[model samples]
Target: MDVPLPLVPAKILTAPTTITQFPDYPKTLILEQCKTIKDLNQIHAHLIKTRLIHNPRVAENLLESAAILIPNLPMDYPISIFEKLEEPNSACYNLMIRAFTLKQSPNEAILLFNEMCGRSVRPDEFTFPCILKACSRLHALMEGEQIHALIMKYGLGSKGFGSNGFVLNALIGMYASCGEVEVARHLFDGMSERSVGTWNSIFSGYIRSGCWEEVVGFFREMLEMEVGFDEVTLVCVLTACGRLNEIELGEWIHEYVVAKGLKGNPTLVTSLVGMYAKCGRVDTARRLFDEMPRRDVVAWTTMISGYSQANRHREALELFHEMQKTNIVPNEVTMVSILSSCAVLGALETGKWVHSYVMKKRMKLTVTLGTSLMDLYLKCGSVGNAIEVFRKMPSKNVFSWTVLIQGLANNGQGKRAIQFFNSMVEKKITPNNVTFTGVLCACSHAGLVDEGRGFFVSMTREFGIEPEIEQYGCMVDILGRAGLIEEAYQFINNMPIQPNAVIWRTLLASCRVHKKVEIAEESLKNVVKLEPMHSGDYILLSDIYASVGRLEDALRLRNQMKERVIKETPGCSVIEMNGIIHEFFSEDNIHPDLVEVYNATENMMEKIKLAGYVPNTTGARLDAEEDDKESSMSHHSEKLAIAFGLIRTSPGTTIRITKNLRVCMDCHNATKIISNVFNREIVVRDRNRFHHFKDGSCSCNDYW
Candidate 1:
């Protein structure tokens, strides 16, 4: 069945001539009545054709109708039609200002106001609001103040749209954004007709400047005044709570939202999750996430970012995957969380997949995304790939260069890392504190003592970037590796900022290297005091005692850990092949090819022992009967990983192993001997530095 078109309204279909017959004519008309500008021009032609151009009411209606469509119709045509009218009325002027305001042509509207006033076609109640709106749109405070003066002079301040609360609120918002908050407050206070929006504008002003306490105070005032809370108010309040970490306040807002029946609003829900997570209440965030009836990109993104911030990388990865399974398109923020999770986990294959996903989705891979990808690659022990990504980037920023330099340092290419830093400087780009920290750290890892000193001075003198705590830590690492334990300690004493745990630990490690017993005791105590919860503190302290032959003190420290009931985090190694990660632990013997792994490990041990290798127990707790800890060090994870590699691969293959802890001196020594005896190269990447083992030598010159 065919549907018939509906008849148009007769009022819309009829003409202005009916007004005279009806005797109750509208004083003004809208341009939409003509249906087309051609029809409108024809009406004007008929005006002149019928000699009704002198009819005052008809001329007023025609000009007003043309001005009504000024913004919507061609601007030039509206101006032309308006010029043809013998005497355009104030109604036409009002429509023109409204039209220009809608078109975002505030300057034209202001000029039109001047023209109207010149002709003594005085503005009425509607004129002031449009003028104020124009001033606000241009952010012209001076002009806005002039209009405000005019408003007061015409008594429009109390009479018309000037007294309208929303218009007043717009003025307040403009003034606040222009850094005239006091003026805004004055206007707000003087309002005889203030709306709730007036208060919201002030509240948002505080939020923009990170003034959470003021936001809270204003919100309280709003509550006390019984001004109804809206969604905008809730979002702002939640944002303030998230920044301040006032968990109790945030929770109260949550309950308020629920009571107000706004629980399921997506923006409110997302903000609540963020607020809870930012306050370190991940459980509450999870509960809200679980209860959300519908999840948008913002909700998923908030959960993913929350997990990332809380260091729950596994959950972040899981949620990202879930988002994909549900067909919710991930935005740039979502990708950042997923990339960060991969970086922390060193999930290279998955990161590579994400890069592919970026390409498939036609994402630009902007500098931020590219830099994050490089960091992920570096964390995954793929500096070559990071460098490649950096080189291919369309635009590079300081952060991008810093990540590359740090990645190189992380992967043990100290010289190359320094080269990258030098290139960054030569590019006329200034290096930030993070970039210098990475470069200096590279020099430390390679035992480039002179280079470290040079860069440290250059950082302050040339770049004008003062050495921060991390930079100080790197210098200590350098000097300590050069057997300058006292110098490192003196450097710490002279530091501008207080030395942190890394500084104390770096000095302690050097003491172990140089067998500096006395300084080691003091450094160890300071480290434990600074970071008692850090397992590395206890472990490093124990190792220094063992090196100094203080067996009793070593045992006492271990017993103190026992008293505290602290369990050591065991070291583990992982490698990805064809997409799956194979995890190996020290002394692990559970591989399906366990027999082969054990036999290969024994043979390698015998070969290295023949090369004058001894299990150097520098890292053992001295209190443990010497042989027991020596045996334990022999079963370190890197060794087990290399042995498994030898059993599975052919001879002469370069073995690579990454472990979760600092490689003890015994493992370091053993790897060097094994690399020499087997006539092969090996790379051992540990928590602190990388060891390139070849021909009974290491890249660190046996200092690290």
Candidate 2:
């Protein structure tokens, strides 16, 4: 059965009349009715055949229809027609220039403007604004200044033009976009009369230059002067508010939007959401996001990113899931934020899903998105994936290289990390302070004290990069970890800058490892002076006392902690299974599967002990019985999380866990034996670094 074509209406089916058919009919009216290039071409053919192509008014109208009116019409069609013209007036030149700017060909617009000048066409009010806009788009400051002089020469300045706000607004925008924000501001301040557009121009100018404080101050000035603002003006000020985290002013803007009935604009609402989110008020952002009658991709992304920035990763992931149910597709920025949340939560499956989506969408692996994905893989203990992401990147920046190096260092691939640093230097990429920090950390983790020292000095001498506190801390770790405790103490004393508590704490941790109680006491005293009420310092000092068999001293230190009501931060471990994250704290008793998990933990402990896993109770309380000390050591957060994973997950599946604090010696030892006994691989990410356990050994070789 053949399908019949749908019948057409008589008006659309009728053959269109050409200019030759009705010589008296207005050709411009026919030009105005053109809905496609074919319709225009028919009229154009008639104009040429009837010798009406030479008529300036008729030809200019044709150009207007082709360049501006008709949808999807190529600009080259009008350009070719204009070139064939014997002479075109200001209107023809202005049409082409404006069309060029709208089509994102600013250089062509400037070239046409120069040709207009060569022909001595006096630029009208419309002429300058179009050309200035072109200059602004190109960031051509020199050409913009030449045009500004022309504006002044032709009496188009504020003093001369009287009320031509468009000209002044373009001037402001051009100067600002050209990076001459001060000049833009000077023009704005000199205006005897100002409009909302004038304020928006200056506001956008300041924003472009990162002068956010200036924007907020001027917005307040606008309010004081009782000026009216439109959606653009409000959005500009709200952006400044978001960047500066000015919540009070942001709230005020929200109120004004409501009172003035401007809440109907989605852009203003999204700005309010962004402002509140940046100010650490995700609840308000979420409320505003929910109240939106319709949500766009930008709005959804802003809200999701807000949760991520607040360190509320679970909420971020939840909102992302909600966004997935909507028709709006997540953009590159949204994926980056989701990946960051995944990294912090150790959600490897979720991160992998996002990666596949990016590939499915055929989106470019931009530097930022690639770096974010690499960070996620590294933090999730997917070292192979991280390396592949780094390798496949189209281009690399210093930060990209730094992330790879730091991630490798954190994953216990320290020697390879240093080789990458060397490769980076050989490629002429100068190491910044962060790069040096990663390099030094790599050396510190690999116990390369001499190499760490060399990099520290070379950072200042060879690269001219000054050592920041992070590098200083890494150097302390390097010295202390290598049993050079005396030199580490002397290094702290001889430092130019004041040592922070972290540096002292690093020294103190090494004291616990080497049982240097006398130096540990000195480090503890300095740490106390810096951070009074720090529980870790007291705990470290007490452990040092117990390690040296000074049981009475250890008891007294514990008593001092009790008298001060100081509480240690409990260990926490996070594991992800079936795309859901589970958290376990020390001696946790609240999980729904607590009974099963406890039974599994007890049975595993028995098996590990039979496999020669002896518990190291050095940090346990000296006042407790030996059995009680060993019992306390058995229930660390990572162990419980591991037990839960082993019981719930299928056999042969790798268990990846992230802990809040560094893994204790006893748990580290037990995890190795567990991996061997169960014939499964286990990856543990503690506060310090990663421990990949398999077949009765760890990647760190028990040094960490």
**TM-scores, all models, native as reference:** 0.70, 0.85
* Per-residue lDDT of model 2, residues 1-704, tens digit only: 99999987767665765543545554556565777887788887878888788898888888888888887777889998899889899999999999999988999999999999999988888888899889988889999999888877887444564346888889998898878988998888788788888888888777777788988998888889889878888888888898898888999889988998887788889999988998988999999999999899999999999999999999999999999998999999999999999999899999999999999999899999999999999998899999999999999999999999999998889999999999999999887999988888888888999999999999989999888889999999999989999999999999889999999999999999889889999999999899879888898889888878888898899899989998989999999988888999888888888888889999999999999999899877688899998888888899999998899889999999999898988899899999999988999999888899999999888877
Judged by whole-model lDDT over C-alpha atoms, candidate 2 comes out at 0.89
| TM-score, predicted candidate 1 vs. hidden true structure | 0.70
Candidate 1, which ten residues in sequence have the lowest lDDT sum? Answer: 18-27
Give lDDT tens digits, candidate 1, residues 379-424: 7667778888898889999999998888787667889998888888
**RMSD to native, candidate 1:** 9.9
What is the clash count of model 2? Answer: 0
Question: In model 1, which regions exceed 4 Å deviation?
Answer: 1-214, 532-535, 560-569, 572-614, 621-631, 634-660, 669-685, 689-703
lDDT of 2 at 243: 88
Steric overlap count per candidate? 0, 0
Residue pairs with clashing backbones, model 1: none
**What's the lDDT for residue 451 in model 1?**
92
Q: Show the lowest summed lDDT stretch of 10 residues, model 2.
A: 17-26
